[model samples]
Target: MSSSLLCLVFLFFTIVAEATYSPGGFHHLSSLRQNKKASKSKPKLPFETRYFPQNLDHFSFTPESYKVFYQKYLINNRFWRKGGPIFVYTGNEGDIDWFATNTGFMSDIAPKFRALLVFIEHRFYGESMPFGKKLHKSPETLGYLSSQQALADYAILIRSLKQNLSSEASPVVVFGGSYGGMLAAWFRLKYPHITIGALASSAPILHFDNIVPLTSFYDAISQDFKDASVNCFNVIKRSWEELDAISTKKNGLPELSKKFRTCKGLHSQYSTRDWLMGAFVYTAMVNYATAANFMAPLPGYPVEEMCKIVDKFPRGSSNLDCAFAAASLYYNYSGSEKCFKIEQQTDDHGLDGWQWQACTEMVMPMSCSNQSMFPPYDNDYEAFKENCMSRYGVKPRPHWITTEFGGMKIETVLKRFGSNIIFSNGMQDPWSRGGVLKNISSSIVALVTKKGAHHADLRAATKDDPEWLKEQRRQEIAIIEKWISDYYRDLKED
Candidate 1:
């Protein structure tokens, strides 16, 4: 009876083991053991800490310019660990001079965490010129140049990084400011797996579609012009509005870029650059779109100009300092003058309109030289307004002004995305209108700075004599990092 029982028990155990195994017996047992080990072991996180040269390399995605651009990223240090998430940076429309001065930056955070910093010429402006090629031809062509495409471009690059490392590298985190902020938000939304996190500084995530908030801009800009004083900015605002109301009729008067483009050196003859710059900044704070983008989220402007300007800008600036890069790029040469020093320009920012009477009256046009900024556009206005209103989550309008061509709206296309999104606005930014924050809904997390400006004026800062600016930048960054980390925590994969 004992022998029978023992034999039966051994047979039963053998049968149970075989039934659970993958059919090849001991070889199957070997696999089972591996599975048990895998279950117990922590799988490797996705990235590697690779050091890049302090000088970030830039090349045209197309064959045109054969031109070279030095997309700068003052790489800090490696991430703290051997296998932390990769950090890759891509920003919106800025020229190399921005890197030369490191204007509007505070990326020391990247190295502190062992992130890789890289900057690319956002396709058009800087040395990233598609000079010889008609790469950015029409709006439809420009529509192709989207954040969706940018995600593809970035993913391709990250895959190359993964292949080079020959390891399961962690995901990347994209960082940007202004339009770059828009890109960062769209990139994560478009490809969450590729980007584990993102930090958007002074980015107008909510204003990409419309920017009528400038009715309030005159006050803010004027107040700042006063150096936190009372009368300083007020005097300038009083003079500016009188002229702006008039200019909006002729050549969309205050839009300095188009006016500057047409008038060139005589910018001072009509109005000072201060009014133009103020209008440019204020109009854009609420509506950050390419000039032509008034019509659609995707634009009829060449893709390069697609990260549109919310308001039409005159091509040049009165402040010689802010005018050079764009002037040089478009006219293909800088005029005899250059940008005045920052301190000098800051002073100039507050001067009374009475001081420059003749110039303001003369250079300005009573006509819309740049057709896109005014009525009777080459493209239909009503349709663009409808699409734009829809894209930014505004109540759709049957008609407004626009000939914009992009068909995809954020609500229609981007709303499909769940969490994994972030946005930013500057408290001091004239454009951080209420509409932008209201439109995006519950899925996106937005960051606001205490004293930030139109863009990441804080991200671009190092040490501030006033001290207030620097602290604000830090708070902005912390908020960004927290949102990103939270996003990563929730979707860290199974």
Candidate 2:
């Protein structure tokens, strides 16, 4: 194979290694169901699942443009009053039900504001497949799946729903976490006339282009480990060298398979490295103050737990052994997974759709160096382009996101036109490296907490929530309340 092909292959392995722990709400659904079964008093689901007919191609004029698909959405009008604010959770890469269930902040504060709750599923995900399940069969069908198209879908759906409910007078506020957060913020920017404001939590809107350092992501992960324990960070940092030395010895791959308790034999050292990297990265992402099942069954302060395991390793245990034990905590925390699988498979259509998006417009660059806890890797755009072309017959538009979303001079542009948007980020989330960390204008605000995890503020409040997290949510509620109050005051004046 050519050098470019080799690079692409390496990149693919790296992505596949991490695919098992990719962020989404699907896992939360299973957890929620389990919790519900355990409860003696089973409560009715908060929102009613509904479908909306959406255009296949929102930006095109071709025959395919007129085609329609049934997009899934959930609605709860229990707290809605006449002329009440409409709170919409812009769906991310997974099922709308998952988001609606996990995003309890919207429901928690709905009654106080008398807001109507709506969560819309993105196209090609959940049951919103534009061409049904065959949408992934060809590039032509998958072409309809893009952020721009999804944003348009939201704008049109909000308009239609308002008209149907005679809610044209109701102010719309969009809420989303992670990628959905990006959509929520972009929705307000692109269709300000449609939405009064947006609460975008953990949204890395500036991750595209060269707006932030490519190393910012891995650096954040490294910092999380370093903060937990320097010794733990050093052990992980030196692990790659130890792994390389071990793999070159006799029966090395088999020894690794046995040590890690892999269900399947190890094929290459790179896969092992990728698997370990995924554990560290994802553990850092969901290192909540309280125990969380977002990625897997993890204890409260999972990073610290992993560090404690690494710090208290047996006297004769090898670095590789310690690493496996820590990683096991992430993958097999429930102690049910008999053996690790280096390769992972998912039936999530949303992830399949996300793969296409990552290849196309959502091309955020990430790399690691000596400064990071993981092994060093450079951001190779050419290699990424070759990989995307090989898989999808298209080149990634690295600059499209910046062009379409206004990444350059973002503060200046958004400060001028943006209003009533909350950019809330938890410092521990690696994605926060690319988030807006400060206020852009009086109306545009950023709420950042050092102890926060990925979109922790957006998750349901718990009895064990840290006081800081509670304060963060309280601040968000207050800001949103002001926006609604001001909107009504202005409407009365008009």
Instruction: Show where candidate 2 strays beyond 4 Å.
Output: 1-44
Compared with the true structure, the alpha-carbon lDDT of candidate 2 equals 0.77
Worst 10 residues of 1 by lDDT: 3-12
Deviation (Å) of 221 in candidate 1: 2.6
True lDDT of residue 477, candidate 2: 91
Candidate 2 lDDT by residue in tens digits, 1-494:
11211111001111311221223422211222222212223235687889999988877698979998899998999999869999999988866776666688999999999999999998888889888786465788888888899999999999999999997999999999988998999999999999989999988888778788977877998999999999888888878788888888999999888877777897776666666766787788789899866656689999999999999986666777787788778777777767766644344334457667777887777666779987776766777677778888998788898898898988899887778899999999888878999999999999999988888898888999999999999999999989889999999999
lDDT by residue for model 1 over 1-494, one digit each (tens)? 01001000000011111111000001111111212211223233222323221111133345432333222223323444434556555634333233213323434565554554445444333434332225443332333333343445456556665565553454467766544555565576666777766655444433222333312322343333333323323232343444445445655533544434433332332333332332322222322222211111121111122112211235342323232222222212123323321111111111111111101110100111121121111222343334333333333221111112111354554455545455556555543442134334555555555544544442333342235545545655565566556655766764
- The lDDT per prediction is 0.34, 0.77
